[model samples]
Target chain A: MSGGSGTRNTNTEPWGSFDDHLIQGSGAAVIDMENMDDTSGSSFEDMGEMHQRMKEEEEVTAEAAATDDDTHDDGEFLGMKGLKGQLGRQVADEVWQAGKRQASRAFNLYANIDILRPYFDVEPVQVRSRLIESLIPVRMINFPQKIAGELYGPLMLVFTLVAILLHGMKTSDTVIREGTLMGTAIGTCFGYWLGVSSFIYFLAYLVNAQITMLQMLSLLGYGLFGHCVVLLITYNIHFHFLFYVLWLLIGGLSTLRMVAALLSRTVGQTPRLLLCGTLSLLHMLFLLYLHFNYHKIVEGLLDSLDGPHMAPMQRVARDVAELTLNASVRSLGVTLRAQ
Target chain B: PDWFHWTRTSFTEASRPFAGLSDVSISEDIPVEGDISVPVGSSRRDEEFSTLDEPVKETILRDLRAVGNKFIHVLYPKRSSALLRDWDLWGPLLLCVTLALLLQGGAADNDDQGGPQFAEVFVIVWFGSIIITLNSKLLGGTISFFQSLCVLGYCIMPLTVAMIVCRLVLLGSSGTVSFAVRLIVVTASFGWSTFASTAFLADSQPPNRKALVVYPVFLFYFVIGWMVLTFSPSQ
Candidate 1:
């Protein structure tokens, strides 16, 4: 569009003089010269002379208006207004450009990292550092970074403890007291680690993506599934082994989806946080149900054994009682016969 | 010369007669019960048993008392006196007996027709270990349920070794070199159990007394039932 047309569109508003000055301050000189060239039948050789004359005339008009108190008021007011508008537009453009650059850089860096290769010839390290630098300005002001750092060590310890306990329970020949103790230890550790890690990761990811903190927390709250899986594995390895594999697969897929979602920028923070939260909650509920039911089922089995089938403990107790009764009867018989 | 000879002869003659008379009296006074009495003699005096003053008698009595005291002390030391002061030795003895009986009962049930049921035997061993460990801590004057549990879990090392020994004894060698192979397998299995238990206890959170006991017991029963139902031979 022509500068004059742009100015005219902006001028129809209350700030017409301001818009005119802004148009003039921007690259309006080129437009003015071209317009003059079209109106005056000037040869290319005379364009420089024509431009000088136009500059002198414009300056004279500005000075004359500045000198005359009555004429200066309107002119000076419009000029200052135009200068302010022009400065605002320039600032806005710069900010918009910077934001675009950052978003693009983030997109590229994440995409490259997720796929396990560089998308361009740029060094992965350089790209990562730049992306981090860009993110730092935004992220350093947020809570997620602090929370993640705070949680990292505790989560590591918890996971390590859980792993150790799980290994112990699985290997223990005594599947009763000792086994259960080990299993519960494992579950507690797993639950604590999962809870902490999920919270941190959700917070970090959501905050980085500019989502609500509460939503992130809620999403992380769903990590109860991982805890339940840990409990299940402790109690019933046969069932839990399968469940564990499935969980790992799901976790991996979810991580991939999160990375993809963040990179794509198709869904903003709110929807992304909600999606992750819902998925996590569903998984957790399923896991909780499995664990709770598994415990019940085991209890039922014990009950069944106690009912008529005779658990080993019961059988031994019953046998001892029977033997005692028999011996007493025999002693009574012997005494009666003697009598 | 004749007078001096007579005096010497009289002295010799009188001493000989006295000695002869004393010997004869000593012989006469010897009791059939094997007691011998020293005879009163013209040449010497005999002291009564109560009036006797021998250096050896007091020394002997003192030595005997000292030796007897030392022997008693060795059998029951001063440190054990503290144990004894709290309760009579019979109390601990009875506790130990009760523990043994419970273990025996569990073990008896574990004996299968073919061989010892390893799972059942393991459970019994685990329980016995826990009871012994808890009693040990209690005797030490600490009532930490979690610490007892952890210690019991860790002490499964000894029980595991015992299990292996039992296995080797019950399941004799089959073919050539079978004995050595069985021993090795048993040893390895025991070692693994020991390591596993140690590692598990090491990782367990320090016990919170209120929650540790009941929850753990409930969990144990459930887990045991589940494991048995899932992995038992009958199942």
Candidate 2:
């Protein structure tokens, strides 16, 4: 207790007359040192009281100095003295200010949509040509130096697939909501895109291949467009057997395109082939997953279309084919139904 | 040095009033073998709460009881700190794995591969919680990192239950009725999770910034609930 008083007395000697006037004007609370000594030997009360006195003194001086010639000095005094109150409060204030600044800085990045336009900008002709280019097994002629990927195309492809799938499913008498179908489609589509792109990016990095994430994203995105086209055709046909055949044919073609893109950037022979094979396998697995889960064969394909140019035997054959197809699809659905 | 001494003195001052009372009670009634009536955050270690020569089974049982108590606290959430005071990750890990496994099973039932869906659910739950915890910490919440995580994870119990109920509903039949039933269950559980987590966490956050801390919690549970609601065993 005596030591606490001694330190306070020593620390206060450095203050000038202005500080003394400020302390005196605040209250006699600062001058009442005897009351503190009678409390306890613990220095906690002493320090808390000292901080309380300093805070009052600064507040009083701040008002007086604001009207006088020491405004700038009092501002600095307030800033420095306010910090000595509570550690947790001070830390919270500092963190809140820093976070506010960081949030604003981050929000500014999206303020200008033009900055994001680079990822979305493409002509209709460009999209058509790119979709056609993706359909080809390989692009040997006029291959660009770097593959330019766009998120807009991939996102549109996903949206289109979700739209067509919902339409086809609804036409087939399946009662599902748009949001549910859209969520599943977007989750599976982008999940595969992001997962496979990161996988390929990691493999490329391992082999020291010079490729950017955008290239992998664009490659996979375009590959997905091929699958999306297959879905569209199958939707039109609504034939289970035809859908399978198209899935295999177009799935293989898209895999080839992805391999060609990867092989062009890589150097080594064995690693290139291994990477290509693994990637193609993964791509096929994703396609198969979609085939089983997402490929809903809308019924009445034969009923909806009329082949006017067919002979009598051909028409009879078409009727028989539709009968068998509808029967088999029904049996499969019944067997797969939950018990 | 002054701050350290000040904190210690304040702590001692706060406990002084209760010291004599506790001492008198201790002399009157000694706690039994399984008595866990020791007040939390006391100066003594957990081992000293009971006898030192306790059997292994008793210790395990005590720990299990503590975990169960936390689950009950989450189920019936009030403005209590029991969840925060005895925080553990075991319950959260269990809930996360169970939910992920149930989701994976749902996919597998459709003759689809189960690995990706399991990993997807696992990553979403864990990654989402970590992001929420980081946000809370960055917002100057007074809670400890693991404490917030524990609350978030334990609150997932309701959603995990909802997922189980959803899977069972999917088993009965899938149509608009089943979908409606699953939707109601998921929505109710999602609300329960959000309320329970915020109840445990609200006190630790700054008064003005409670909404900031809660918005992320709301989003985190909403995403999980969306996954649960949209999950179809057939698909």
Residue range A125-222, candidate 1, lDDT tens digits: 43334323221223122233311112112222243344334433433332333334444555655554465445545655654554344333322332
Clashes of each: 0, 0
How high is the TM-score of chain B in model 1?
0.24
Model 1, position B223, has a per-residue lDDT of 35
Evaluate candidate 2 and give its CAPRI docking class based on DockQ: incorrect
For residue B169, model 1's alpha carbon misses the true position, in angstroms, by 5.8
Of all native A–B interface contacts, model 1 reproduces a fraction of 0.00
- DockQ, all models: 0.00, 0.02
lDDT of 2 by residue, A81-159 (tens): 6644444544665576557545544543222333444665555557667777777766652343356777555655554
The residue-by-residue lDDT of candidate 2 on B52-161, one tens digit each, is 68999898898889889999999999998788766788899989999988876553232334556677677667766876776565555546556777889999999999
Return the interface RMSD of the candidates, in order shown, one decimal each.
56.7, 20.2
